[model samples]
Target: MIAIDSSAQPIQALRFEDDGATPNSRFPVLLYQLKLAPAHDNASAFESLFAAHQWTPLWRAGIFDYHHFHPNAHEVLGVARGQARIMLGGAAGQALTVKAGDVLVLPAGTGHRCISSSDEFLVVGAYPQGQEDYDTQRPETGAHQQALARIARVPHPEQDPVTGAHGALMRLWQ
Candidate 1:
């Protein structure tokens, strides 16, 4: 079943179409269990699942303390270990705690940061459509307008980063 936690007002989501944040696209939602079987902390598990969905692996690292986003492509973050509180949609965003078995499908240009986390807060990140290149754009960049345009041009992934095809991501994203 698709789990929707609206506890953060508009759920685990934030729209950045105002002020000086992202220009278009709604922030990602946290999925409690997108894939029940591959919900462990094994690197092979995450690599295999993302590969099956064709969402190429970009990095395997913990979230950074600084706020950032990708303006060239969307991303998927799987919590391979531990838990963390993330601030999404720039500084004025919602705070979400995600643990192992949880997945975050972030749209292009959605801001995110690791507010606080446990010692073993490992994450496996992937990009859509076998993409590998990305730019780390801060919300206060001078090229903010260009970033927004780039975000608008980014194509939506044909498959979900976790479940592919008709997964909850497809339903929520489209």
Candidate 2:
């Protein structure tokens, strides 16, 4: 399946604040630069790996080119092919390039959008078991408060998409 680079440094953790327009999460986003096992170098492998960790793999596609957040659920995106420069958080956020074998774990209400990408870019996305049908929210002047309320109510996932119970998510989110 997926093999974490033990020799590599620890996962990159990024924090994005609520930028008035987009209600970002209180939790930091977890970025994992995975080293896929030789025989598991495809989209299916990512899906299988996520599923095994209780993150239900539900979609295979490119990221949206506009800023949006999931207010009701967390998300995990695994880069299966090609590469892309993406913006995390709202207009006042950071841009990151994600290539094959990279995994991004976004907490509920974390804004994200694809800035630019290679033609062959593809990602496999998943959510915690019961959150597969997550909502897509864009910046709306009046909806900010409502979004924040929902975000506050969203529960911490019991398992990390890449690691199970005692993983980084469980530790950091606590």
Compose the digit string of candidate 1's lDDT tens values, residues 1-174: 222221222224435553476443664554544333444445556767777787988788899899888889888887777889988777777777888767777888888899999998888888877357988877765778888788888887888766568665667766
What lDDT would candidate 2 get against the real structure? 0.88
RMSD of each: 5.1, 1.9
Spell out the clash pairs found in candidate 1: 6-11
Query: Model 1 segments beyond 4 Å from truth?
Result: 1-17, 27-30, 34-41
Tell me the TM-score of each prediction against the true structure: 0.82, 0.93
State each model's CA lDDT, in order.
0.71, 0.88
Residue range with the least summed lDDT across 10 consecutive positions in model 1 = 2-11
State the local distance difference test value for candidate 1: 0.71
Candidate 1, residue 124: CA error in Å?
0.2
